[model samples]
Target chain A: MGKPPPISNRVRLHRMLAGDMTQAELGEAVGVTRHTIIAIEQGRYSPSLETAFRIARLFDVGVEDVFGWEEQP
Target chain B: MYQDLSFREKSAWAMGALALIITLFYLADVQPISWRTGEAPPVDRHFIKIAIATIVGSIIIQSVLAARNPKEAEAPADERERLALARAGNHAGFILAFGSVAALLHYLVHANGDLLFHGILISLLVSTIAESALQIFYFRRGG
Candidate 1:
């Protein structure tokens, strides 16, 4: 089981790159809930493949660019 | 509607609402009965209410499903939804089964009829709440 992190620097960076795209707007683009976008931003959860692809596509970047591994144990 | 969350999360929203309302209604009904009699009913009023409620709930659920996509309801749960539900159920089953056995053993040892009734009743209730909680968790976490 994974725990949620306090903040997702990746998502923060994504927003910065996009000129402050809100969660609902990101969710709408990715076909997910606003809650999910929030979760991603907060590191509470990760998205499925299709959604990841959608997000990456919207940001004009690869999935790896949008999501990154946390500093390891 | 928000796009592309799985159907299970949507169903969980409906089911969780039904579970909460029905559980509260059941407690409201059963509490008075238990208090007056000082005994839990041998039969499950909760189960009965859920069954009845689900009948209406299903109609409402189906209607919403139709409103969303008629074809979707006709199709079975998608792979992710099925996996989420199965995982949640599988996780919850352990507690449910343990609770039942513990209740039975308590009855065997103590032989308190009223307590047995309540123990089993509470077991069912706990299982239901756990199931709903797990669904919510799975919905929040991806499947």
Candidate 2:
């Protein structure tokens, strides 16, 4: 398996703040399956770099706002 | 460790088990005793019966299992699953090719066509087993 990038809680919290948008709709907008969206939110899978940008664009947020650097300490 | 196995994993397990049983059935029932009186001779008619039984039985069993989850069975492989299968198949092919070459060399020394055929066939069997085992391992290891 390919090495996965660090996790981000931003996507989960953003989805929740957007009136709890369903994972399926986000997946549709992001051009991936609902399962993939779920995986991303749960940190089991990280999206490709391009896909991550697509998701941020759809949400009208900066990429950094949608994803945070994992805690260093 | 990956805690849960996908549908493909379950299918691999079943297929592997079925393949093994079929191999044993071929060896035990289809293998003929030497017909030469008092002196041992080469076993009779190995290819024809094995070919028929293995082809027919595999088709039937795989069809039935696939029927149970037609969608999952028919689905194009996902990225991770594709990679796993390709790697496994690549590794398994080497094992089969090496074994077959070794067997052929042995047969060359002995000048035994029957032995060569059996050896090549057995290498095919081992390859199948190895591929399935590798699939199971990859599935568990999160690929």
Candidate 3:
């Protein structure tokens, strides 16, 4: 299994706060597939700067609010 | 079981499976004849038939898939999907080049023109299948 990316995200948390938004719904809003959202939430993949900005914009949050750098152990 | 997989992922799986099956069929048809004749088998009508069938079969499968999910079929691949495909193709290129070099070396040693042709063709088919399989793997790994 691949190690998780150093980036971490609160996508799921934001989705819950956004009136229980579904992954598919968010994906469509952000021009990505549900699987990409899932990967971002699970920290298995990191999005490009554009996608990151889109996601934050969709949630009405700053990019730093949605994503954080995970200090490597 | 694969319901969660995206349409592109499903297509990759189907194409990979088809390529593998076709490669097996081609080898089965050619190997024994080559063994018996001690030469490259005659370029048979069967080769053309199989080539056409493979192409037509892929188109039919892809068409059916697109009919089932028109929107997804029409959507272009995202950045991650494109990256996965590019990486897969890169690996497949290495495989094809290695196979070609090996085939050339075998031809130089055995002087078997028929085997060289068969080897290179098989290499092409194998590389294509490998590319699809690699794409599936990358997609699942979070592309």
Candidate 4:
């Protein structure tokens, strides 16, 4: 596996809060695939700015609320 | 197992397998003749057969995959998939360049046009296989 991106996200948490939304639902809402949603949730891939905003808007949260940077040692 | 994979990933796997099979078939068909003649075998009907097999095999594989996942097959590549594909292409370009240069260098020394042609053909085939492998890697590992 590749090293995880420094970005971290609470996409899964948001999905849960949004009536237990599935990754496919979120991906459909955000114009991506479920695999992309899974990648975002796992921090294996970082979304583009437009996608990030779309995801944040879908969860009714600020982009900062849904996403954050991991502290590097 | 295929249910868990995305359509693009499934396509990659299928294409990769096809390319590998074709590469092996090409080598098997040509190598014996080259060994016996002590020179690169001339391009002949075998190459025509290989071309026909590749085109037919690709169509069947793609048709089967698309028929199974029509929705996904129709969908355009999403951001992550696009990125992975671009990265895979970039890496594959390097492999192609290296193979081509090596083939050219071999030609410079051996001065055999037939061997040069075969060397380049093999390089192209190998690079295609490498591209598919790299795409699968990027898809699974995240680009």
Candidate 5:
């Protein structure tokens, strides 16, 4: 398995704010599978730029709001 | 884990299992004859049987899976899934190349064509199984 990306996301939180949207619903809205959404939410995988833009647009947030770099301390 | 397995992941598992079972059956059929003769046996009924079985089995299994999840079946691989597959395939390719090279070197020393053939064949099967297993692992690890 590959290392997890050094990124964090508020996708789950955004989903909750967006009418408690389910992962599958968000995935369909953003043209990815639910498993991909789950991986993004869990920080196990980083989204492509296109997917990141899609998620931000869906949640009406900037990419920075949806995702943040996790600096190693 | 099984319940939460995605359709693609399930397909990987099924294909891996099928590859293993078929390879084992092929070996069981051919190895004994090769051992009894202590010579390189030509391809015969077992080869034909395995070839037909693999193709037919894959079609049947894929049909059943597609029937169960037509939407996912039609879905293209996502970015992460594609990455995982590529990585798995890359490793499998390395294994195949290394095994083939080793088999050629062994043939140089022993000049036993039968051993070389069996070695290369088994390496191909192992490479396939390794690719599938690695895909399953990657899928579970969140690719």
Candidate 6:
């Protein structure tokens, strides 16, 4: 397995706040697969800039509110 | 397990299994003849049979999978799936290059084109299997 990306996201939390949206629903809204959403939430993948914007827009938040850079020591 | 897997992952597993079975069958059919004659067996009816089997089997397997998951099968690969596939292809390309080089060296040493042909063919088969395996790995590991 590859290392997880040095990125963090609140997609799962935001999904819940947004009427408990399911990963599939979020993925469908964002034009990605549910698996891709799962990977993003798990920190296994970093979304493209376009996807990041889409996700943030879907959640009614700025990209920075949804995603954060995890500083490595 | 099957239900948990994505369509692409399931396809990879199925194709990998098919490739493995075909490789074993090809070796079983040719190895005995090569042992008896003390030489690489010539391309013959057995090769043709294997080729036909591979083509037909691939079509059937793909059709069955698509039937089971029509929407997913019809959708184009997403970003992550594409990345995993490209990475698998990169690694498999190395294996193919190494195998081809080894086959060429063997042909130079033994002056046997037949063995060289079989060696390259085996490399292609093995690399295909490896590519599928790697794709499965990437899928499972969240790549």
Query: In model 1, which regions exceed 4 Å deviation?
Result: A1-71, B1-5, B44-47, B71-82, B110-122
| TM-scores, all models, native as reference | 0.58, 0.66, 0.95, 0.97, 0.94, 0.96
Model 5 per-residue lDDT tens digits across residues B27-127: 88887887888764647677678779889989998999999999989999988889889989999999999999999999999998877887887788889
Model 4 has a DockQ score of 0.82
**Each candidate: how many clashes?**
1, 0, 0, 0, 0, 0
Instruction: Using DockQ, give the best candidate's number.
Output: 4
Model 1 clash number: 1
Model 2, which residues run further than 4 Å from truth?
A1-73, B1-4, B29-45
| Each prediction's DockQ against the real complex | 0.16, 0.17, 0.69, 0.82, 0.67, 0.67
Residues B83-109, candidate 3, lDDT per residue (tens digit)? 888999999999999999999999999
Q: Among these predicted structures, which one has the highest TM-score? A: 4
Q: What is the TM-score of chain B alone in each candidate?
A: 0.72, 0.80, 0.93, 0.95, 0.92, 0.97
Q: Write the per-residue lDDT of candidate 1 for residues B36-94, one digit (tens) a residue.
A: 98766656755577568867976898578567855445556533455567888987788
The complex in candidate 6 yields a DockQ of: 0.67
Stretches of model 3 off by over 4 angstroms after superposition: none
Which candidate number maximizes lDDT? 4
Q: Model 1 lDDT vs. the true structure?
A: 0.68
Instruction: List, residue by residue over B32-143, the lDDT tens digit for candidate 4.
Output: 8888998755578767877899999999999999999999999999999999999988888888888888889988998888888788778878888998999999988876
Question: What lDDT is obtained when candidate 5 is compared to the true structure?
Answer: 0.87
Can you write out model 4's per-residue Cα lDDT over A1-73, one digit (the tens) per residue?
Answer: 8679899999999999999999999999999999999888888899999999999999899999999999978
User: Model 6 misses residue A24 by how many Å?
Assistant: 1.3
What lDDT score goes with residue B107 in model 4? 82
lDDT of 6 by residue, B74-106 (tens): 988888888889999999999989999999999
Error of 4 at A18 (Å): 0.9
